[model samples]
Every structure is written in C-alpha cells, then in structure tokens.
Target: MVLPHRLSPMVSAFTALWKQRASLKTLILGDFTQNYLASYLGFAWAVLGPLVMIGVMTAVFQFGFRAGTTGSAGIPFPLWLACGMVPWQYMAEGFVTGAGAITAYRFLVRKAVFRMGYLPAIRLLAGSIIHGILLIFLVVLLFCYGASPSWHWLQVVYYFCCMFLLLLGAAWCSAAVSVFIPDIVSVISIGVNLGFWLTPIFWNLSMLPENWQIVMQLNPAHYIVQGYRDSLVEHRWLWDRPLLAHVVFFIWLFAALFIGAQIFKKLRPHFADVL
Candidate 1:
C-alpha cells in the first residue's frame, strides 16, 4: 500500500492530469475542426491567413515605412517579418487564451480538485501546436522562396524552449488573476494591443533612435522577437551571455509561476461558486 503523504501530490497531479486529457484532446480536435469548418479551402486558410498578412506588411512597410537602413538582416523583408510574426503570434495567442482559462470552464472549477491547473496547460498546448504548424509552413515557404537554413536554424529548438517557459510562467499568472477578477481578461486584451505596438513587429529595432532602443530593451517580447529573427533569419546562436535584463525576466517568470500557483489554489475554492 502507498503512504498517503508520499502519494498525495502525485495522486492529485495525476487525477487532474487525467481529467484534462480528454478535454485537451478535444480542444485540439475541435480547434482544427472549427477553424476549417467554414472555409472553402478548409485548412488551407491557416497557411493563407499568415501568408496574406505577410504580403500586406511587406507591401505597406516596403513602401510606406521606408527608412534609410538596408542589409542589416540576412533575409528578405517578408521572410524576416514572417519569422517574427510566427513566434509572436504564438506568444500573444497563448497568453490571451491562457488568461481566460479559468473563466472558460467555470463548471469544472466548481466541481473539481486539481482540474484548474490543467486548463492553462491545455490552452498552452493548443496554442503551441498551432504555432508549430505555422512555423513549419513558414520554413517550407521560405525554403521554396530560396531561403536556406544554416547552422543557425539549429537554434530554433533553443528559442522554442525559451518561448515555452516564458509562456508557462506568464499564463499561470494571467489564469490566476482571471479567477478573481474576470476583468483581467479585458485588461489583457488591451495590454496585448499595446504590446503589439511596443514590440518591433513591422519595423526593425535598428530603425529606432538610440535612446528609444534602450527603452525597448525592457520589453521581454522585444528580446524574444529579436531572438527569433536572430536564430532564423540571422542564423545566430541563442544569446551567449545572460544580460541583466534577461536575468530580471527569468526572475519575473519564476515569480509569476510560483505566486500564480498559490493564488490559483487560494481562489480555487470559490471558482465554481462565482461561475
């Protein structure tokens, strides 16, 4: 027989894991089904959506957003934009979806013990799969358009891991707050909008003046977007030395996960009641 104390966390974790397995699987299947349900081309829309956006950004920026800088990047402007868009989309969608994890399934939270944790995990997984598919499509498109990967492509794996950890930490915090104040979801919506503008999406950071560049460094997404462009387009390794800023980000992520879990546990009792 197993000891109660020894098996407690494992048992709790496992029960929650099993509860979510079906929901998570269903989420993936449902997303794929619904995403393509109305389209004449079905799943082709996934590829087409990003490609179309890539085309629009390229055209508008190449014409309207022109700066004096050139050749700072190794890839074409469209390919460079695609590289940034693919990962940034993942991060944004993951956080937005994760933020409402608790509110989405109010019934389960009211009835279950460990199930709350799985909601965010499932949302993250769903976003991850979508992002992964988009990345693969981008790679194939780039290759077809004559963009070849060097040893730097090897760094994609590392960048992906970084993005995952960052998402996990951020998602936990967002989900935690969502349980207490449903308005957190709205706040996140506005925040993501601001984040998109703050981030170097259509334009390169080099285009910014020196003082503004220093300010942009404070945004975690900035480094991450730059990291993706570096690894995929620039073919560089993950940052070699951890800077002071990165250290601060790592600390924030850790703190968010730790504090968020406790907050989730604390508020979990009332989730069902509120819902």
Candidate 2:
C-alpha cells in the first residue's frame, strides 16, 4: 500500500524526495566522478560522443542512404541534425541511467533518508549536466552554419522541459520495474536502439508520403524533434504548431506520466525488499 497521505502519490513522492535535495545533488555529482573523472578520456567524452554519433550518421545518410537532409530552407542538414540529436540523447540517456539507479545504489536501498523515488531524478540530473554542455556546443555550431540568431531559438528551453517531463515520467516506471527485473537493463538497451531509428532524428518526416507523415507525427519524439527544428531551423513558435499536434503530444506525455507514476508508487514500498 502507498504511504498514508491524502496528497497524490506523485506529489507525495516528489515532496519527500525534495527534502533530500542535498543528498540527491551530491549523489549525482558523485555519479559524474564515478563515471568519467577517473577515466582517461575524462570530460572530453561528452563532446566527442555526440560528435562521433553525428559523424557516423552523417556518413550513412550521405553515402549509404543518399538522403539529402538539407533542412528547411536555411538551417542545413548539420544544424538540423544537432537540434534533434541533443534532445534525443538526453531522453535516451535518461532512460538508461534512470533504469539502473536502483541497482547501482543497492546499498542505500534500506536507508531512511534516501527516498528511493529520487533515484530517477538523481540520474536525470547527472545526464542534464552533460546535455547543457551539448546545448552550448550546438549554439556555436548554429552560428558557424550562418543560422542567424533568432528569438525562436529560445523555445528550446520549452522543448527541453517537455522532454524532461516525458523522461522523468518514463524513468520512474523503468527504475521501479528494473529493480525487480534485472533483465530490464538489456531490454531498455535494445529498445532505445530501436527507438532511435523509429524517431525522426536521422530522417525527415517530409521524406514520407503524406498519409504516413500524419502517422509519424504520433511518435511523441516527433513533437520534440519538430519543436527543436521550429526553434532552430523552422523559426516557428510553440503556439504556432497545429492544434492537433499540440493535443496529440500532450496526450501522449500525460499518459506516460500517469501510467508511470502509478506503477512507481505501487512498487516503491517493495523496492527495499527486492534490493
């Protein structure tokens, strides 16, 4: 049973987790040290990783697929690709990192002050630090591409928050489930790889026939990819998106949040038992 609180389970979990804010921040910092600081490549991996991924994909699209992603009249393929790539990497990292939170910190599973629910948030925090660095790199890239500074570029903040909400909601579910099922790590690994292709990061939806284009819009990541392009490439405001797109995106997001939160709350009490 969920704790005896009249507040919504999500609200309760969040509030409890908030009280441990310092520990959460410290843990996330330690995660950075643990993951990268001791390594030879060190912090350089953050920039190199995205650059290499882009290089590999660009090679494929240019040669393998002969795909011309010249990007909306002015943006060019590289800038367009960066916008979609950074946010998608954020979400993908959030899933993998958050899913492993519980097991990685199994020793703290029994600690009273360690509100287990904060595990996902802690992981997300670590990932976001790297994402923020990437965003700066993207800005430099855009300038180099001669994509003049525009106010629409600010809309990336809104899209980042949207992606954060979606990731957190999904993370809760993944973290909780993975605690009881170790195989979930592998499942999430495979799933993210599959999702990367399904998401419209590498290819443009406009490449598809009109009928299939409508269906592609249904993929929740499409909203984010388009939103990033809107901010950087298309120069469209968030409100300028079609009403149907807005409705569909929010519905998809909230469904993930609602379902994930319920699963998380139901399983939270059992976390220590399993770990």
Candidate 3:
C-alpha cells in the first residue's frame, strides 16, 4: 500500500520546512514591513491597533455591562484585557487569515515545486511576529502602571510555543479545507468571532457557574488565557503542576496536528485543480 521513496517525501517535506525557516522569517518581516511602510504611522499601528481595540472593549465592558472585573483596581482592567487579548488576537487573526492563505495565492500554488502548506505557515509566522512585538509593548505599558517585570515573565516563550502549535494546527486544517470549499472561509470567520466571547478574555473564568466552569474547561483557549494570566498577572510559575487538563491539551494538540497533517496531505494533490 505504501509507495515508498527511498526518502519518504514527508521526511523530505519536514526537512524542507525546517530549512526554509529563513524563508518563513523573511516572508513574515517582509509582509509586515511593506504593510506598515504604506502608511505614515507604520508599525505604530501594530501597537495602536490592539490598544484601540482594548480601549473600545474596555469602555463597552466597564461602562455598559460592567465587564471590567479582571485582577483589581490597582491593575487597570484594560491592561488585564491586553494581557489576554494580545495572544488571543494573534490566534484569532492567524486562524482567520491563514485559513484562506492557500486559495489566496492560487498562482503560487500552481507552481510545480511550491509547497502549499507553507502558505499557512508563513501567514502564521507573520502574525506571530506582530503579536510578539505587541507583547513587548504590553510590558512597557504595564510598567507605566508600576507593574514590575519579573524573571517569570520569560515563561511567555514556552506558552507561546504551545499557542503557536495550536494555531498552526488549526490553520493547517482550515487552509486545506478552504481550497476545496470556499465557504469554509466564511464559517471560519464566524467561529473566530464567536470564540472571543466563548473564551474568557474580558472576564474571569473562575466567575462562571460551577457547571459552566467545568464545561468551559475543555476549551484549549482557556488554558492559553490562563497561561498568560499565570505568567504575567499572577506572578507565578506557568501551570505549576500538571493536571488532567494539561494532558488533554497535549492530546488535543497531537490529535489536531496528526489529523490536520493527514488532511492537508490528502487534499494537497487536488489543490491546483480545485483552486
């Protein structure tokens, strides 16, 4: 059943992917640089975009519905929201935009040697870099409020890897599907939009009803939000002790990657035809 090349194409694909790390980085920074260069504001918008959204959400939540219930008064709820939203936004944006990446570049997909999957990977890398810069800006903004940066803050790197893999897997599936079903892009947009409220971004997860709290525990985004809170606000070690949920997250991560990779591989051959 197996048409084995002396070197499996998948093995070669992995090596190609790793070797193209510089290519990925170049694409990320290149796209980001070009986009910002078009405007006078430039990269300021990177920091400003999230800041504006946080401000708008803060006003609506803090004033209209009284949703500014994070941390405490000493730590403004806007900053707390930023702590969670920064990463969530990256995941959200990466999933939405990366989903359509393959179809968006049909010309490139038609190229004989082009790897279609890398399209989504490049999109995610770009989004992650922007999010990384926004995160550093968050640190400076937090300092303005007298929050001292602790060595524990570096733990974001570990959590970021987890978050990136989560997004990458999701992107792989969505991008692959989008090639066959154009409608998938619309569905993904709706899901990302809905995910914002479903996950605990503006409010504390602990405040949910006991049953709902238990139910929401299944959302991987919850763990990511908790990771951010733990590393930044709680001034504590990230997920100090592993539990069933951590196991579930790893299981979910592996399962998603496995399924996504298989799905992407299965569908890849037909992409040029479909696109």
Q: Identify the leading candidate in terms of lDDT.
A: 2
Question: Which scores greater on TM-score, model 1 or model 2?
Answer: 2
lDDT of 2 by residue, 1-275 (tens): 66535337667767777777877889889888877676889778876798889878877777687765566764566678888898888888887888888888888889876677787887888888889999988889888977688999899989988888788888889888999898998899899999899888978787799999999899888899889888987889999889999899899888777777889888888988877
Q: Name the regions of candidate 1 deviating beyond 4 angstroms.
A: 1-47, 65-74
Compared to the true structure, candidate 1 yields what TM-score? 0.80
**Model 3, which residues run further than 4 Å from truth?**
1-14, 33-46, 63-69, 72-74
> What TM-score number comes out for model 2?
0.91
Task: Identify the runs in model 2 with alpha carbons over 4 angstroms from their true place.
Answer: 1-7, 63-69
Better of 1 and 3 by lDDT: 3
- The global C-alpha lDDT for each of the candidates, from Candidate 1 onward, is 0.71, 0.83, 0.78
Tens-place lDDT per residue, model 1, 1-275, is 56455334334643666766876688656655654555778667655776788788888877677622332534577777888888788778777888887777666775644466777776777667677788888789678778777787777777677776677666767887787788888888888888888898767777789999878877778777777777776765666634765776667655655566556666666777677
Per-residue lDDT for 38-147 in model 3, tens only?
A: 67886687668878998898998888887545664455787788888998888888888888888767888888877776777777877777787888878987888788
Q: If ranked by lDDT, best first, what sequence of candidates would result? A: 2, 3, 1
The total number of steric clashes, by the backbone 3 Å criterion, in model 1 comes to 1
| Inter-residue clash pairs, candidate 2 | none
